[model samples]
Target: MIVELKNEQFYLCRHLLNRQAHLEPISVINQTNPGRVFVDDNTNPTSGMVWLGNNDGFIFFGNPHNEKFNQYIDPFIDQFLVEEAKKVDLDYMEAIGNSKDWNTTLEKVFKKRNHGNWNQRVYTLKNYEYLDKTEPNIELEYKIQKLDNRILTSVDLTNLDTLKENILESWSTIDDFCSKGIGFCIIVDNEIASYCYSNFVAGSVHCIAIETMEKYQGNKLAQKVAHTFVKECFIHKKLPYWDCMEDNDPSVAVAERLGFKSYFRYIGFDFSF
Candidate 1:
């Protein structure tokens, strides 16, 4: 039997999710707002069936001890989610985890429904790029700026009406992180042309996210802005963490130029919800 988890079952959910987190730290997707968590065994969550991850994707995990848990892994994944996805018109969703059995069962789920592979890698860099100057040394045609304390912590993204609404969603997730988070960007006509910021963080591991307006690409805007963000990280005693798909040449090159090194490789799936 399946049960949708709520606050009453938070402890059990956290315990099982953390069991998965041990294998994938960044995979510890939901922390602030708990996403939908479903479990077959509320009493022994980690010992049986469960699923987790953030809104972008999910990480499904299964415990070995329960026979009922393993028996229904495929149906729990395929039939239940397929029907739910159809109900919500869930366009895209990807699920991954540390369990081979889960992956094996996931294959059957994919065959029954529809899903595809989303491959990616995790990267990190510890050697901080220290500089004598607090400000970035790089130059740009657009005004290069560091996030001010006020806007850094919180900003009315609605004020940025010119930017694509989807791109500005970072404010919702990273606002709180700004107190400790730091970032740099190039602005053109009061619009962010290219920028880099610490998107999500776990302790000293600051995950970096950067994007340049299509028109602004190829100007080395990403590199300069990211380098500036890295300098900011050092000033604040933070370690920059970088991750990208192994197939992402530009991302890999930028990280390499910024002195990021390969940390580990893990399975990543890409599919529609």
Candidate 2:
């Protein structure tokens, strides 16, 4: 009884919004991000799941006890999702459930292929007062720059390909990222050493993703770039969001140092094909 919903049918999933544990699903359902939604009932969906267009992952929302929907989960994964993942050359599937009940359902259904679990932490910046406003002193060899159009689209820019790939992992396209997302980077001798960007945006909230070159890890470049990105979010009246693996000590340290408070925790699962 499951069917893929068209763009117009996306609103039908609204009732299940309250169960969402992350902002990605909201961005997808709102049509502000690219993704596909499948539901048990298109007209009055009681349960549904979103397949992120970026091929990064999936999110499950709505009634966990819906018998019909639960029955379809297996085929949805073993068949439909498997074929779709092939297009992107993905060997595994990563997923998140909106609630504990949904998580339990996913655990049961994916039990055969489930490889591991990820403990994720979500952080919120309630007030700018917690922000460490101290600016990082960069060595003269390193310079910070905005991820502008030139940097986004320039083919010959040093490390631009890697940068674009990382961005597109979360964003649908470089053009879309340029239009809606914000980013900052640290450049060392014309090579990108570290960067941060809005990984997902739902309404006025933006979730941040950051990375630093292995050689540049100890320099606090992530914090510097994130500070710039978050400050930009504030100037534009947007809320900065931070999400990371629970065991990611460096990410946890940076977020906390930036004044973001731990808001919630969620579980993620990876299923091997």
Candidate 3:
């Protein structure tokens, strides 16, 4: 029951998870277009899986093993994982880890011996409910040419001067999705009030961060912008996934208003400084 890495098996693992939920396959193994190592047990194509990239090893995805498989092969898989870690120089800071059984291994692999400090959070779309009656405070609008408007431009984060001058800087990540994904702004007269962007991944779409200016707080512009983005995700046949720190209440509140539910909790650990 030795598990060996293979390419087709990796794709099957990804397909299985996508069928179950909107989770993003961890970036550790899937860093390259057609990545490196992929794992499989001889008897079961997906008894367990592992993926190794340039410098890091990842247990990218896995299917649960039966009692027989667990007794016969789980130990070998564990040993294989440790050996892979050593081979790749797996530094937690530089490496990404994702697995179905992360809760069990998090402490052994991620924790500082006695300190044991870790934080995790996850959120999902709860129920699909349409806004039958719009509230007065909730303002929703759409503009096809919003990106062309000069005032709606995102604050540049590349230049040192622009980065230092602005309290909020633009995200270059969403720039690539310009015409395809939704570009929205909650405006006040000619000024940009707040903004949000949505993007598609593996047939599903999710909203990234949305923010309102500090001076415009308490006006619910953040919620408005987020709701608008969520609606767009639905239209595109992509479910919106919300990810944020557990303590980020404001962002979580907006998700709740938009009918997002908590699906799984994920904690990130960085051991290498």
The models' CA-based lDDT, in order, is: 0.58, 0.84, 0.47
Model 2 over residues 1-273: C-alpha lDDT tens digits? 778999988998977975336888898998877889999998889998888877767788898888899888887788787887888898798888877777889888777774688999999785555566655776788788899888776665688889888887777788888889888988987789999988788988888889999988888898889888888888898888898999999999999888898778899998787
Better of 1 and 2 by TM-score: 2
Give the TM-score of each candidate: 0.72, 0.93, 0.55
Consecutive 10-residue window with the lowest summed lDDT within model 3: 163-172
Rank all candidate structures by their lDDT, best first, as comma-separated numbers: 2, 1, 3
Clashing pairs in 1: 91-273, 92-272, 92-273, 93-272, 93-273, 118-268, 118-269, 118-270
Residue lDDT tens for model 3, 1-273:
555545544544544342343233432223222234444454345444344332322333455433333343335434564565666465343222354454455444334333233444555552355441332264444222233224334453123232122312222232434534455666554455667654223344453656676877787777766766666666666666676667788887776667677766655444432
- What lDDT score is found at residue 141 in candidate 3? 48
Runs in model 1 lying further than 4 Å from the true structure: 7-30, 47-54, 62-67, 70-74, 77-89, 99-102, 128-140, 148-175
Best by TM-score: 2
Better of 1 and 3 by lDDT: 1
lDDT of 1 at 126: 64
Per-residue error for 204 in candidate 3, Å, reads 2.4
- Tell me model 2's lDDT, rounded to 2 decimals: 0.84
